[model samples]
Target chain A: MTQVIISPAKANSMYWLGRYTERVYLELHLLRICFDFMIDGKPEEYNRYLASIGNTFLYPDLAAIRSGLVHDKNNPVSVLACVEMANDNAILLRDEIMSPTLGYIQMSLEYLRHAAAESKEPDLDELQKLTDWMLAFWGSIEERVYDERVKNFLRLGKLIEHLDMNIRFSYKFYRIEEAFTSLLKCYDFEPRAFSGDALEDLKKLITEQEYDPRDPVYVNKVLLLLGKVVIL
Target chain B: MQSLIKNRDSVNRWMERYGVRFGVYKNGVFNEQLFPFDSIPRIIEKEDWKVLEKGLIQRVKALNAFLWDIYHDKHIIADGVVPEEFVYASKGYMPECEKVDPTGKVYSHISGIDLVEGKDGRWFILEDNLRIPSGASYPMIAREITRKVSPITFVENHVADNRDYATILKEMMDDMNGGRGINVILTPGRYNSAFFEHSYLAEKTGAVLAFPGDMTVEDDIVWYTGLFNEKIRVGAIYRRISDEYLDPLAFESSSLLGVPNLFQAYKKGTVAVINGFGNGVADDKGIYYFVPKMIRYYLDEEPILHNAPTYLPYFKEDYDYILENISRLVIKDVSEAGGYGVVFGRDLSLEKLSELKELIIHQPRRWIAQEVIDFKDLEILESNEKVERKADLRAFVVSSGKDVKVWKSGLTRFSRNPDSFVVNSSQGGGFKDTWIMD
Candidate 1:
């Protein structure tokens, strides 16, 4: 295995790549639900969908924000926004990721940017394709990325965002377990929690998923094998 | 067609062989990427290029005169042709170049003038890029690959050769050497925007690519250092950095990118620098409006090409009209280029237009408004479908000895977006290989 040494620039890219790819993966699922609801004659519930992510901040009103989120070229936090961020991070880490992986990301972003500019409601199938590409993209990274420093830094970033986004999206059990297990494995030191209250909630979340087939304990063992704490 | 483009993998190999690429910074981070090459060609006829060649020469000669006048005695300003404030206040105008003329009164030995042909087939001068203009290397390499892809295509067509750009540049450097030593291409580093062009040019011309740290000035002579304090005098430098970042002692004091006292060496006649410092005063967008007048004033010949119909908002009448018709024009900041600081009036809301109008009024000198030319579209393939998009051409004019020679083909860049009129490569555009058929 090639030892991946994370330079400062690559660290920044890893952190943002985590922020951006997670943003895209999570939003595509959210937008999929919204699009499905549009077919069911539940237009009123769209505002509830909007409220789940704080419509007032990202949009002007619910309608302006929702449409903008879907297609606005100016919005820095839309689906296109997430892709742009991913593209930018990928561009920065071209040498680290090697050319082929970077080229794929660049190509994918180019497609998404064009799609966003042309269509107000882009084909959901194309969006699905991008998500699948992103997943395959991860596998490719795992294969090509040989340096441990870069791998750990990228994993640390992935875990941080995984924890943050799963909590925000209200993922009940499995996703949260996956996030914590990743967190424990990637970081040597943990950041301060909110008076240990957040830690207590985390412990409860773990206990709640204790006996599930998709078990938290399985994650615990993976973390330990990766030289992380065997947190109960 | 598929077989022709199957050379994409081969083309990538060719790029590796030729070491062709540029560095771009996204979010303050630098990355080098292979500027993708397409096998398609944009062909022009010889008869059409003869006119373009004449106009480009006339334009570059006048620009050279303008740069000399701006740096020396302000002749254009004193003659009341251009405002003195415009000359003095322009960001590209350098005081350090004052009283120092380049060898044989030449400032722009190599000029890249960008032009575009309308649907009616009349070409309009888009802008005059007198500084270190890039993209010439792209077509240089592309021509080679295009021949490999389909050799019979070149045999059937009488294509004017474009491989002499380096020869012309070399002769120009040698002309002004004044018995000094080796000529070099001074680059900021490996991460500059046109690093590929700089390196390729150095390789092609057999000139060393020397960074600032690799050089030192002693007794008004610029000497490049070899390993461990070995030194050799450098005669001519085709530098790829802007003037402000060329020499810290001459322009910006805090510029770490610049070599200190390099301009002093230039002024001492110990070295030659192509497209000399302060040439930007001529390439300034505001200065673009006066090229035809300069041609008439200096060269006494009718300009062979026409500038795009442009309006200077600093003039009261033009300002009022641009304010009123803000929804139809393209307004650009006079000092910015590379597709930055450009606003399409049609894209602005009424309220936003009013706000922009107020800002323009506040600083009229900084703005120029132009009627958007219905720039002709070129066909490109998108998702297996032919799409028409706006594109522009940049012609290279190399001044060697006593002549301004135009390369037969130029780079034709097209906006990938169907509706976008801007085709700057930095703005996510693609290029086509231009061919001048005999």
Candidate 2:
């Protein structure tokens, strides 16, 4: 019956661990889907897709674009960069996470680092393994994290990132609604002003059949609301 | 042993997974590096550990009694067993902690005593670390990962388990909890060099890993504040911060690391502070010279362990001896730790030796010279080849109430540089898990 108080610093790290892990996972998946464009040698489409996700960098070839997506440490959006940040955060919360769980993060990072060092031709098969490890990472979180409150905070950060990614990628309104529904089902957040009320407003818009999903202002407001957390 | 040698990198990888790292700050930037692990372990026969356990327990007990006397009755100093100047002038001596009764009346609840074995099979006490000593987790977790890397080696060898450190630590903390509340491990933050240890021990002990701001002091009581504003009273604090930064109101005015009025709470007798404040007096290099005298004066017994032949320049005879043997002794600055401020006579040029001799003559109290023991060299692997390295053991002994226990394992640190004798982790040394054979 020893006391277990998570310092604010650790809680904040766990929150970001959730955010960065989800961010990298989503970005990696999106790029895997975009690999078809890379294969077709439509570098322009990849450029357009990168711009759509707020990446303004210009690349002449698919290799440069692929490098920016997967390996570039300087590029903040790369899988390697996001995983490194997530791994850093996870390192601080080693007690909160499982040993095998953290091992996955470290091994995945080392594998990516090694791949980057070799600078070989892009191996999509290996890149897909990164995605698989992300799944295992979340699975480990669900299995190993003991404190429900701690887990809830992590899940909340992840849900917020999920909502943000869906919005930025312009997923269909139904898909956004489904993700929002899941967020409401699993997420937990600290109670604050505008969070509860704004959440309800977004729910109202999402559930309403008459609302137009094309309205930018309405979509922005809904995005803001879906960022709020609540257990279903 | 063969399997362990082959699986060294795998164990190191597991250490990285567990974030076995130490942080260092240089040029105002913080950098963290792993405390490299050597697959080879330092092995001690059970008979040797038996002697070590007895000596360590006896030494810690004498040191604890010394702290109590230094603060309360001053019998040791008044009777002239130790000079009052030596005890009062130490940097770690806190005047605010005078006469404060610690939990179970224990001052040094935990002690990490550095020891080395000589070539002639005799052990020498290098130094005593009474204030917030670390490096225990290195050997503890190293044993855990080592077991993974070479299970067959462990299955075959009769090594005593070191994994029980957490349970023993928790029991000590429980005993230290003289009041009604929860135990907390208060750390400065994640930026500390031993932050990994702070968190790891907290997790294992089920103690709260808390920062300065997570808790508040009110009515001379420490409270752990939750996000929902619920407060839990703290019974005992295994505080890892230095005494100067333990309480802003009581020690340093500008320290943000300290909790405001925490010393007030401790003074009010609501919380137990481990290794009690002002204990630096007992571990001071100057005071170290008097430990044998203390063992006799307090315990009325002969010391079971031996200190390396040491000469205090503060005494005229010892000073004369140090001057005569300026080319054959190792001189240490009383103020420095972590392998800093150590000078070997042979390493110094004649000019430097003369300069050091002059400084010692002027400020005799600041220097202590010792005839370096020809310590045994342990074999360590470097680049897949076995090489002999100078290494020393740091043994952690925990005491609470009447119970005292020496942990079965120790951290054996070896100097990575071929020419260096200092084996501090801060000095780029590496460590191996110490196995006290069952």
Candidate 3:
């Protein structure tokens, strides 16, 4: 066997792949609603819905979200950009994921590249095919690779991205719980002590009964929930 | 079939999918690019391989003996086969490793020797890369993909299967470990030149790919630092970094890339460092002059392979010869590898030749001048056109449990430019899948 150089760059790569792929998945889920509103309901109503989510600056108009996700590589939140990020991270972490999975990523990138080059509004079927391939790529990864620490780190990246995008509120709470719980069970983290009052506030968010999703306290509640679950 | 042969785009795509790449740094920025593969392959006959295998094993064994002698008794130096100045002055000579025996052996556990066949059809030694030689995993994997893509081509030919490289590696790691815990592969990072290869072999051999930060030294043993729980003991580390960069405490005090106290840990017999320190002593370009002598002294047998006719500029007579025939020689700096610091006398103008002669005279010990051999070229398909380029084979020899096994296939790198004889892949070169008939 040949001598291999396992560097920090590769680890960051694995960590980033976990984050960007999940970002793509989360955005695709959001696009379903964005697309539905554009076709069936009014674009004005969808814009209002996006504004309520916060970071409306990312996709301010429903029509913009519908047309811009696949077209713009400049948009940090765009699907095209997310896939590009995934490809970059995948190459960096290529040693951990093995070659077969990497082969799938290369194929998926080519598919997206061709789709973006030819289509204005990419056919939903073609978009779904690329999405499905990306998901399948992740699925095969779970089956074949078995380093729990590496897996949990990847999940930590995904969860953090979800929290950043303000999409964690819509995510199944149990999924976040499972990810946090697994991080706790698998690795013994040595974190620096928190000196601030966020701890008490986080405690109140979890213990208090009025932490409801229907109120204007949506962001506060989600933050408290995410914080309580993660700060082991 | 014709379409397959002419498909440059498909081959490039396949290279990306298979991850055949080497990293290069341009203007202080690192970039990874595909190591272009030519559809054409270099074939070796069964009879020829038999001779080549014997020669490689013989060469590697003598190198191993030389490394042992360097660290232990200095008998070779005492016997005056290799000059004391050559042993002590060479940058590869490590004084810190004196009297420290690793697993009761001192030579390299892994060696990648570069060789080329001259126009006369005789194999000549190009260089010996005993320090962390790469590109074995490349041929091991590329051959598999190549065979899969062109099954009929494989069926028609008698190419030796290159899949056992990982198994051979496993055996080597295990032999060094003495049945210890898991074998871990230490990589510099994915940005390193052979990062793709590092990852592929780690996966294939079931060795955990670990970075410097991933490891910790405790109780004199090396363990993988876990994020959550128990740290697993790493018995053997097939490190890819050079010895000077492996342990900051032992070598370069300012190097952040190395694991701290790694040398002390290895000295304690807690971990094994494959391709041991001081292996580089035998690979120095000046050391090439004495390898034939070392073989004769150590093994009492004649060398099977021949070194290119070389002149040691350190010798007055040889310096005179080089100065007289300066335009016909290939000059190399003893300290540099990877196609760097090599200058062809024929390519230089008269003024440049005069300047080189002065430099050689000023620092004679720093250089070696060899008679240029016109090696055979291989046909490579680049942009739908066939071109011939100078190529050389880097053969990997792995030693485990008192046995040395030579992998059948080698990395056959070729220069992309027609007039260029240099074939280091980092210098805008490409590689061909080498086929060794058994």
Candidate 4:
């Protein structure tokens, strides 16, 4: 393998590209579940969904929720904004991540723009295609990116985002533990970006006998510790 | 060829899928628009391509020789082959580059020479873009898509493969670097007009795509700043930024897009800067009138290519002739490029014509007049209908050490407007792929 030199700015971009792409993918998945619940006449499920992502905006109805979560450019956590952010970073890292890998993000952004222009209800089928593209994007990265360092940085971001989202949604302890284990493996690739003390503290907190995954205080503690683990 | 044309929409959709775009700024706002690709290629037969290849190689060699001469011994100026006034007065001539030698003594590692075929079946040299010429990537990527969309087009046509452009480019960069360190393509940033080409070439050539501040020079050694603050040496830089905005401390002190001591590192022979500095003196519009003479003076041979019938206003006889034929010639301001500062005398009103003539007369050294060549119009597909449009070819020449090679395929850019002759992408023109028959 050729010696790959990743500058600080490019490292930051790669990390965020991984984070935002994963954010968009997981958000779409969560939105589908919430939309299915709303279809069953559980309209307040939208408020619970917003609270899980730490969004304070109280969307009035399903239409408002759909518009706010998917099309609103002003909302930083909106699907459109996250996709755009992923694209901006991908543009910066074009040479690191080949064009075929970046093309998936570009296609997703183009689709969302067209959907937003029509101002119709979010199409679930189209969103499924987007999720598939996101999966393809990661698959391309794994196949096309030869530099191990580049892949490691990107995977670190992906693992970090997965753990964050899993904690936010209060997933099972075993699933969160599995994500943490995968994140640690990525951290082993570039341990300098991680804090040793923070990693130990987080591990201790997660594995403690009294630890409860559903407790808000325990979840907040894990979230704070997860944020501190990656200094970069 | 018919199959390729039939699949034009599929080719374009693939282009969009690959994010093929160029950025343009209008009214201080930046916009990235897809570079429109016409399916119909400008085909060059084997016999014609042989002559063109030889001519381009000869022309670029002479130009490189001229750059070396003007910057060093200046024998051309001393022997009265090229005037001293034309050399020193050019905006491209940098006094700071008097004795700085590039690695391998190759000034123009990459040269984009523009040419137009006249109606009489003769090709005329339009311009020599030795300073950071682009558009090679447009056709390079287009060929990738065209081949994928219409496989039969390749099976039927004996077209030369242009995919080796990246290989040749990588070879040139490696030759220049001489194994001193890794090679890098220095770009201003993502907002620049040719950012796509910059990143694309970097990906293709396996060179690090570096932006401003990604590199720093300390003690005349250029280094790429790693993520953990470790410094890696950089040997050769195929810089895409213009000369004036290259090094802040050397040229433009207020330029935030340049490394502070990069020029120092280059001058110290620690780094090889591709298309070496002070090349503007050779490609200047006024200096273009002397390229044929340069060919004879430097190469001791007759010119292989013909420059357009150009008149330099700095000369007394050509000045008088230009004044008499003001309405028929095209006046060009030597300082401006990218289809700017070009005026056809016939397009000007009587008042505008008088004002232009006054400007030319006052700044005689800053203007050149050329008799517009009646170039052949190429047929392009527009709205599913065929129409003839003015087109020109930009052939890329890569010089690695003492060897020079011209890429077989060139960028065939055509004006979208029926009456316009400018084919620059900045002026809203589209491009087509140039196919060189094997």
| Best of the candidates, lDDT | 4
lDDT of 3 at A125: 65
Please, what are the lDDT tens digits per residue for candidate 2 over residues B166-192?
999888888888656888888898789
Per-prediction DockQ, in order? Answer: 0.02, 0.41, 0.31, 0.66
Across A80-167, the per-residue lDDT of candidate 3 in tens digits comes to 8788888888765555677777776776666666666765675566677667766877786787667654565566566556654443
Per-residue CA lDDT of model 3 for B166-276, tens digit only, reads 999888898898865558888887778888888787878878777767787877788776434346777888988888999988898877667888888888877888877
Put down candidate 2 lDDT per residue, A112-187, tens digits, no spaces. Answer: 7878888755577877787888889989977877787678667766877887777766677787777777667653
C-alpha displacement of B412 in model 3, angstroms? 0.4
Residue-level error in angstroms, candidate 4, position B263: 1.6
Q: Over the full model, what C-alpha lDDT does candidate 1 score relative to the true structure?
A: 0.72
Deviating ranges (above 4 Å) for candidate 4? A56-61, A208-218
TM-score of decoy 1: 0.65
Query: Model 2: how far is A12 from its true place, Å?
Result: 3.0
Looking at candidate 4, what is the lDDT of residue B405? 98
Candidate 3 local distance difference test against the native: 0.76
True-structure RMSD for candidate 1: 13.3
Candidate 3 C-alpha error for residue B350, in Å: 1.5
Per-residue error for B277 in candidate 4, Å, reads 1.1
List the global CA lDDT of all models. 0.72, 0.83, 0.76, 0.89
